[model samples]
Target: MTSATNPATEELTPFPDHTQLPDSDGTFVKNWQEHPQSILLTDSITPILKQLHPEGEYCIGQDLGIYWRLTDPPEKGAEAPDWFYVGNVPPLLDGLTRRSYVLWREFIAPTIVLEFVSGDGTEERDKTPWKGKFWVYEQVIHPAFYGIYEVQKASVEVYELIGGQYQLLSPNERGHYPIPPMGVELGIWQGEYQNTDLPWLRWWDLPGNLLLTGEERAEQERQRAEQEHQRAEQERQRAERLTAQLRALGVEPEA
Candidate 1:
């Protein structure tokens, strides 16, 4: 959270309200094998970001179309990234659910956009200017960072927008790319998440701590409480042994 401060606190030109924006009408199609991974990525990252900014001033979207521009007759030009995060935007607009993320209305593009390579792999890396996912993200949406995760290969590629062009980012010694602005790193993790066993893309803090999901957090707390309980029980047993020895010696042990 050091460098990834809320943008809402900055002074900028007033943007249009959510009511004035056109809906992107993005629909999510379920891919039993791949869709769940996207959910796991979002689920893992959202809570960590929320904890960093407790004001509820961030938006983490999954498969929601990001409307980057307005066209003639008010066409919705949006491409839905598997997962995206925009810091400093309201989690909801005017207390209403967001149908799509409109860039013009929000006045801020997403800080990071992630696409999990599908089995076929045609769409995630498409480079056709107007219709390509890569083109739209690089030219129109212009996120600060873009990541592509290949589940099968267990590899990830991250690109940083340098001088309005995406430059390939090299991984550190730990095979993770550090996203300095967000105070996190992107890396591939091999394990079970959400009851599904697969290699999934995950986030880590600067100190190399894996961000935990709600379930994982609960499990950790449970372990700590159990450890404390065991320690207390051991102390009680030791005291009882000492009291018994004192009573055997005819010395009245105070309760």
Candidate 2:
């Protein structure tokens, strides 16, 4: 639903300083209502999550705070990416825990950045609230791929940062972008993720096949095994019938 209560955070400011931020045991869902987009987009990436990190070593949601501080006193700095995926970093931030992803310390940049465009008036023309985010991610964070998905409508725009500039990445005929780093493609499919099938992002194999979720994969395996078992049983029955016919003909079957 929403943020889980942390007993450690007493008299909590809606926004806590980096140093004062409480330590979490790597649960990104905490305080999610305060930041719903983080959960929504992260959920959108579920099929690709394990494929991105089968070992669960390198990934961070918005709550981890891997964003540039844009505001004086850094109020705007809290504009975390909806969901960002980093490659090849320790699963945990420090040897202990991390409050926000500090660029200076980690020396790591997310390979992909996703933004959910809430229906704000100015977002249409790349105005104030939205432009600031783009500038920061492009100039400051410089994430390789930046994507924006609108919820109230059906539209997804992805950007690729190349040669010190952000360029609009066009989708193929089927509206999917091949992400070489993740070894798959991402697209806006009208399928379910987190029980809501509202244009979720899905991952595909190199041959452009949809990647299966853990549940879907298990179901596939079970179905395949059942098919194989049935085929083997049929073969055994055929062999027995043939052996019986040969013996009846007085031609002893050689096992």
On residues 60-178, what C-alpha lDDT tens digit does candidate 1 reach at each position? 88777687766553434667787888898888887898867887777688899998776666787778988888889988899999998888888999999999988999999888999
lDDT of each: 0.81, 0.66
Clashes of each: 0, 1
TM, every model: 0.81, 0.69
Considering every candidate listed, which one attains the maximal lDDT? 1
RMSD of 2: 10.5
